[model samples]
Target: MPDTAYNLTVGDFNCTVFSDGCLIDPDETFGLNCILIEAEGRKILIDNGFGENSTGTAGLLLDNMKTVGRKPEDIDTIIFDHGHIDHVCGTFKKDGSPVFPNARYIITREEWDYIKSPPGDNETQNGFYRHARQYLLPLHDRFDVVASDCEILSGITLVPAHGHTPGNVMVDLSSQGERLLCIGDIIHSPREFADPACLAAFDVTPAGAIKTRAKILADAARDGTFVFATHFTFPGLGYIRQINGVFSWAPI
Candidate 1:
């Protein structure tokens, strides 16, 4: 049983992390990490994971939420940093019903457009969206596409971070002087921290990804902001620190 959860407190806000417990050990693959943000009686979900159909080892969102005293319907708001299957598939079920039926879904307009109608025809370019098509397309109307940097609530804001995906964004959070960034796929592996210019194999725009990855890495290092990565490993929580002349991942 890969049911695991971690509690991170930022000031008075609570971010409960749940992992689907599926790790791929080939060339440094990634597992999924989902988060629930609770504050002022509002329950917001970051991303849902690949649902119950991912690699037979995933789909632990619902159960793990239960372990942490949260129910599916308790999710008042659902936000996505991107639309990759591993991150968005759990938003809707095979029957075309939202897992968090009562929660509002948020995505970047650019990401949704790419998922709905990818710009190019390269199989690799759109394959990830294709994998998530069946489940995500049906729930299109449920999405509240964001196009600018705006606060999702009192403390959470969406910051645009293009490159890895057309409209990938970072969930910026601040509460009581503490700052945290849920950087989606900006640096999938800790090794990338040592080489911020490193690009992932699935990078939608190689050049842009390098720049975006490096910028976020530098900012996080300077600000000493705690980051919640969707991949990396279970809990997927860490901070960026500078050592020598390069950066490194200091997992907290």
Candidate 2:
């Protein structure tokens, strides 16, 4: 199980990246990274993470929360990058009540629609619909809708980057003129930092994902925006740099 959490601060906001755990197989692999942010007098948790129902190696965000002296009840808001199972299952507990009962939830309306009323014959969409039916559907009352590029708070905002899933988005954090973007599942492999067009096999819309990834890389470089890729190596925070016409990730 992942027992450590990475703590860092951006200007005035503090953030902790908690490992829910990882999934590895000969054929496929990925990691689960949930973030807890303390900003502007509010406690916000990003991505509910895989909960108790996940493999034994996961479901430890709450435990990690305690290690950092935070309790589930202390969180006042929860924001999601998308409605994927690994990103949202932790919002509910074994008996189905919300894990952080006091926190208000936010998700893009496109994502809200994708999960609440998934339409299509695609198997992957069907699977996500099933997961949403069990996890997010019951939390409707506490959920709020936001635009693709809406400000979430005084110094935080959500930006659209749809591809990995419909309505997928990234978060923007700014304070004291410093900027960072929590790029949700934008580029899982570091190699993609150099080749922004490469698409993950599971991307629901490969072309859209490619376009978004390219733009994120270009914009981050142009804007000096630090980046936090959800599945990047530990710490995950970094910046994009261009060297000899190729982009590389420079971890901070």
Candidate 3:
């Protein structure tokens, strides 16, 4: 059975992380190890796991939500770190309707565009990109597309960390003097912290991704911020610290 949902209090607000489901893709597909986050109450699901593989495996999100006393309708915001399949595939039901009827969705404008006009001849090589456009395009009318850095709610700020995708972003939450940074796929593996220059083969622009990852790590380390990586191993929460001018991630 999956572990019970966990919560981290950020001042007066509570940020709970849940598992939507588990997937076992090729190591090359991930390039680095990762897990997804399913947060509840003031609910913000960071990403939706793959639904294409098997209904039981991909749709585990609803079950996990129920386990925590949350229903699909209870979700307020569905934040897409980027429109990758593992991250956004669960947004719709089997009937192809919005899963979170009442929640407003958000994604970087750049990412939205890239998937809309993906590079040709690269179609098969970019399965997730293709899936994102096909599935998410219909829901475009429901999105609150953001182009610049700004606050999404009282304790959450969207930090544009482009490169992985044109408008890939990270979420920052600050409350009661405590802060947490939800970095979406910035570093696929925690090990990347030991070598920030290491790039995932899937990165749209590997070099740009490296720079962005390093910058976010540096900032998080300096502030002693709690870090949430969408694709890190289970319980993807951690803290980044700088040692010898290099950043390292320590799970919290």
Ranking of models by TM-score: 1, 2, 3
> lDDT tens string, model 1, 1-252?
233888888877888889876747566667679888888899888888888657777887888888767888888888888877778778767665777879888888888888877447666766667755667777677779888486898889999889998888989878999878999788877777666455365688878988998888888888888898888687888888877758887777
lDDT of 2 by residue, 3-103 (tens): 45888888899888887777564644566778888987899888977787676766778887788788999999998988877778888877787789799
Tell me the number of clashing residue pairs for each predicted model. Answer: 0, 0, 3
Error of 2 at 18 (Å): 1.6
User: Candidate 1, which segments miss by more than 4 Å at Cα?
Assistant: 1-3, 195-199
Q: Report lDDT (Cα) of residue 215, candidate 2.
A: 82
- Per-prediction TM-score, please? 0.92, 0.91, 0.85
lDDT of 2 at 11: 85
At residue 151, candidate 2 shows an lDDT of 90
Error of 2 at 101 (Å): 1.5
Ranking by lDDT: 1, 2, 3
lDDT of 3 by residue, 32-65 (tens): 1122223334666666665443445444666666
- For candidate 3, report its TM-score: 0.85
